[model samples]
Target: MQPDDIDWNIINILRESHQNNNSLARELGISEGTVRQRIKKLKEVGILKIRASINPDVLENQQLATIAINIGESSQLEAKAKEIAQLPGVLNVSITSGRYDLFVELLTFSNKGLVKFLTQELSTIQGITSTESFLMLKSYNRYV
Candidate 1:
């Protein structure tokens, strides 16, 4: 679906603040019903999602890491990524172009948890040629 000017405005406003339909309508100079309908349509088309976000660094015992993975065969890239995404602690899996075929973001309990995920969970997946993990020590303005 093509997002028109009003839709883009709504998205921009939503990014700044997830206000109620009445407030959004007031700010955008539109009716509350219009705001509700637009928001519903945007969500239905996968263009918008409203959810709470928290910084992982503030969470106790939680550690964030990114793993660069090389798939043995190009044909298996998508399948392997899908499989990996279902694993525990995997926050996101992206197919990319570079030295690695996929980049996986993980949120483990601690350093030991990260180790376990690498050695136990990730290692069990076939077609994964190699992986390089980068554990995030500190982050600024990072929320997921």
Candidate 2:
């Protein structure tokens, strides 16, 4: 659904305070049910998605890795990316241009887990010709 001024206001208010629907109602001078209805509508029409954010460094043994994959068949890029996207720890998968056919970002909570994900899981997928992995040393900023 296209967002109007009220929808934008409601979205901003929720971004500032995600848990307080009543507070949003107060701020917007509307009923709590109205806030709930609008948010429901937003979600129903694929306008908004809510997720909790985590810092990988704060979690013990948790780390982020990006994998660049070169596929033999360009026609199978989307199918291959979809298969990779279904794997455990996958955060995002994208079909891209240039030398790489697909880029995948995933989180691993242990050294062995990363190894298994790369060697055991990734190796099982067909059409992948070569792979390069980059593990993040540190994360400074994240913007949504």
Prediction-by-prediction clash tally: 0, 0
Runs with alpha carbons beyond 4 Å of true place in candidate 2: none
**Could you give me the TM-score of model 2 versus the true structure?**
0.85
Report lDDT (Cα) of residue 97, candidate 1: 95
List per-prediction Cα lDDT, in the order shown.
Answer: 0.93, 0.85
**Clashing residue pairs found in predicted model 1:** none
Question: In model 1, which range of ten residues has the least summed lDDT?
Answer: 49-58
| Model 1 Cα lDDT, one tens digit per residue, 1-144 | 989988898999888767899998999899999999999999999999988777889899989999999999999999999999999989899999979999999989989999999999999999888999999999998877
**For every candidate, C-alpha RMSD to the true structure in Å:** 1.4, 2.2
TM-score of each: 0.91, 0.85
| lDDT by residue for model 2 (86-106), tens | 998999999998988889998
